[model samples]
Target: MGAGLAMQTAVNAKLRDFVLSPYLSSGFSFLMAWVFLLLLNLVTRQPLLISGTFITHNPSWLWLGGFFGAIALTGNVVLFQKIGSLQTTVLPIMGQIIMSILIDQFGLFQSPANPLTWAKGIGLVLIVSGVILSLGLFEPRDPLLKAAERHAGKGSQLFYQLFAILAGMLMAMQTAINGYLGTTLHSPIRASFISFTIGVLSLILVNLITHAHFSNIRLALKQGPRYWWIWIGGIIGALYVLCSSWLVPLIGTGQVVVLALFGQLVFSALVENFGLFASQVNRMTRAKIIGLVVMFVGVLTVKFITF
Candidate 1:
């Protein structure tokens, strides 16, 4: 899981390097994803297309999801660019676990998960505590304070942090909506394809209204043919998503999230600690190591309480 999440982060970082408009990144990715799936369909002699009714009959809440997704994807690219892969990867898992718990507990947006329990409830408290420790929120003297202020330029670091949180919340919403759609449509891949396709289309329409340059669109696609590996990320991303959908219905959404969180935390730590590929990850401090440990403990608490 950690490796996959790291790859996802790396994919976002690669997207950021191109410096295209946000909508273009998402739009091109969706197009690439569709093409990849089409190629798979041809190889297997199976039709993998979504129907028109799926789009037209979507609930208003799902439409709300498209709104969140547009912001989230754009924010993810920007955040990954701004903060590098490690913190961007770690912070969002914290946000997602908490948001998912609230949605599951309260039935917010009509999610289909069971209510929170004693173990899960304590798990929430542990998660909050863990995030605080992981972020070094209580440190008397933060090591990165001076450097962070110097490097962040113009906008506040708080803004970047908020963007990360918003991205995570939108991700949580996207996950819950996928679960609902899977239950309603009885097809995981179809649900994911439709949801992602609609979100990308909605973003593209917004860009059209804003008069974003057509050249950026072309430029984004041009890079795809030039760098096949980057475009391949979309294929792996789509497949991971499809498998996630299938797993959620069989194993439960919360369980799937817990596993994803564990995967992300571990991989993000390794990538950051070793500075693999000359990534922005700096020397690991004792506090950061402690933070990762706390976060993992919180995950264990979350899983144990539920079981």
Candidate 2:
């Protein structure tokens, strides 16, 4: 899922000019995935269902995972609700950075070996530091934070911490895998469709075993261009997968990851301050500005410093 987020920027960079209406390509890719998933449902005997009531009452943007710290943590979300927010946030990010360094060092998942350079290593450390500092993850906890952990009932959650860290490592692995698949297929659109289709099947199988139920299925999807931005999430998703696939072939994997993170931080600030695309106004902070600058430098150092 993190790779899914990182890949779109690469897609935008790579395929923006080469393709005829890249978003349209993205749309078709999603459509293909849906068709594949629909077919899978036929053989698998699990209808793609949803909770109609749960979605009907929520703001539409919630579907895009904009709530961030809540669902982004997933399994750790429950743990986060138990432990303080800082530990949960910090562990995964630290874990991801550590794993990405290893992935680059070993050239995992068909990646060309981009052995860790001194500059790259230092930059990654700075990036991690900035992430922790900007989020105040290292700051002292307040009473509310301590109170919130009551559900966890005051015990060492070493297990969830390790689990969260492993999840971050898995994200790094996912990006490499996606990049490899995209390169092999020679089409980001096809690669993304395949990824999405597989994801749908995987989730459906999970739901089938769990015997999950939903209040309703959201069937009122519209493809009109005017309403395009609303469903643009799908386009962005397919586009990112395509971009990552294309980028891995050129820049190796870690640089793609760094550049994508830099891009996300830059644009996310813009969206938050201006309330673009129905996003919330997060008002950038001094620390956040510092963090972005540090991250940008890290990205430049990682990508441009040819050692």
Candidate 3:
């Protein structure tokens, strides 16, 4: 599932190249996922509508999971194009870890409460240190870092970094909210479908407000046969969403998030090192390897180390 999330970022980044607008690319991705989920729900005989009494009883904020998802997905598409896969992956991960900690500690969004502990605190510090190492911050001469500094001014670069972290935070929130929604809806698939439906609507509103060009959609379709892989992004996204919703209920959100983060970190490293999906090649250095090891340890500490 985490690998799918990383691939979704790469695929959507490529899709943005053809679509010429992040909003459109993300909207199309959500649309495809929505359609796929809709079909799956139909085939599986899942109910599309829930009772108004159920709706009235639950908090309205529960429905905003898809809204948060739309922003996070769109933000990832934009960040991947701007910061390369490595930064795009790690920055959001930092935010995700922090947000997941908050959710677990406070029982936010109706998730089970697991208060913060010294081990968890130490784990977070290690994870942050690992992220810094993975980013090659100590090596001032790294090619990717220099390139980013040269291309985007310090102000713009900082903005993108912050945005990436914000996107990750929203993703964590979306997971928790969708988990509760799944419990309420009694079907993870239905929860996924609802999430995608709201995501589509959110993207549509954003596209309309931004006056995004619709012509690019036509161009993408014309070029679709040659770049067939781009279309699979939505399918992958659908699966990731379904898995998260399903897993979060069975396991805790923090566990599911950290496990997914592990998958994302490993797969994204592969994507960066190998230049998969036509992305830029950013070789994994020794520092990055050590950083990954530290992160793995941190994840273990957070998951297994008790009071």
Candidate 4:
């Protein structure tokens, strides 16, 4: 999943340009994802609706989750163009863990203020180290994967890396915000729907003001593409938004970050194993396995360890 993970942000943004205005694309990504999930629940006979009155008449600030998401997604496009995807993924994740620590400690963005502790510190270090190791920071990477880095402008790398870091850190905050919003609504899915709706409206206004690019999107609507996989980003993103919103309040954002990282690391390996989404099949390395083990310990340490 190395390539796929790296490209998803940029590809999602680019896909937006092709399918709709940039901001609409951003907002609409969630819309597509919500629709797909609704269909999935229908097909699986799973219950979809839940209580959601607070979403309609809650804090005005609660509506900003999608706005943050749109900016974060667009920042990734620039990062991919400047620093390549590996750096984009690794640096941002590290930034995310750090920000998770800060957010949890301060209860930033309505998150419950969980005091920072030694065990959490140790776990954070372990998780960060494991991520670095899993990415093969000290080891050689594939020549093909390295090709993207080669084309990157050296002068801009640091700036882009910083952008990636900031974006990653913001991701944690966004999740926390969404979690708070979801709690108000009494349903994560409902909160997700509102966030997407607000985001879609905001982007639409922006697009209309900037370039009035409705024609392009209208054309896309008229002549749909043949490929099925282009819409996959929405599905994956919906899962992230929904799960993070549901899990953050239950587990606290700190544990949610660690657990999410673990899941990402594990699923990345699985995706690579099967070459899902045409990502390069990576042979599992002993080092990566060791890193994963360390990350699991980190998760346990973060969630269960106290003194």
RMSD of 1: 3.8
| Candidate numbers, best lDDT first, in rank order | 3, 1, 4, 2
Against the reference, the lDDT scores of all candidates come to 0.66, 0.50, 0.88, 0.64
Q: Name model 2 segments beyond 4 Å from true.
A: 1-97, 138-168, 218-231, 246-258, 270-283
Question: TM-score of each candidate?
Answer: 0.80, 0.57, 0.93, 0.69
Tens-place lDDT digits, model 4, residues 1-307: 3233443654564565466455555555656766765665566555555446744666666667777776776676555435444444556676676787798799777777889899989988887777667656677777976775666654566677678778888776676677787676566676676666655666666766777555565654553565345566666677766666567668775576556665555655665555444444557677777776776687678667888
How many clashing residue pairs appear in each of the predictions shown? 1, 7, 0, 0
| lDDT string, candidate 2, 152-263, tens digits | 5545566676666675666556655655554554544544455565544444544456554321112213223443333334455545555666677798765776666655
Which ranges in model 1 have alpha carbons more than 4 Å from their true place? 38-58, 137-155, 209-228, 249-254, 275-278
Model 2 superposed RMSD (Cα): 13.0
Residue pairs in clash, model 4: none
In lDDT terms, how accurate is model 2? 0.50
Question: Deviation in angstroms for 163 in model 3?
Answer: 1.2
Candidate with the larger lDDT of 2 and 4: 4
lDDT of candidate model 1 versus the reference: 0.66
Taking the tens digit of each residue's C-alpha lDDT, what string does model 1 give over 69-188? 667766766776677566687667767777877887788767756677777767667766666666655666655866766776637667887778778888888877776776666665
In model 2, state the lDDT of residue 164: 62
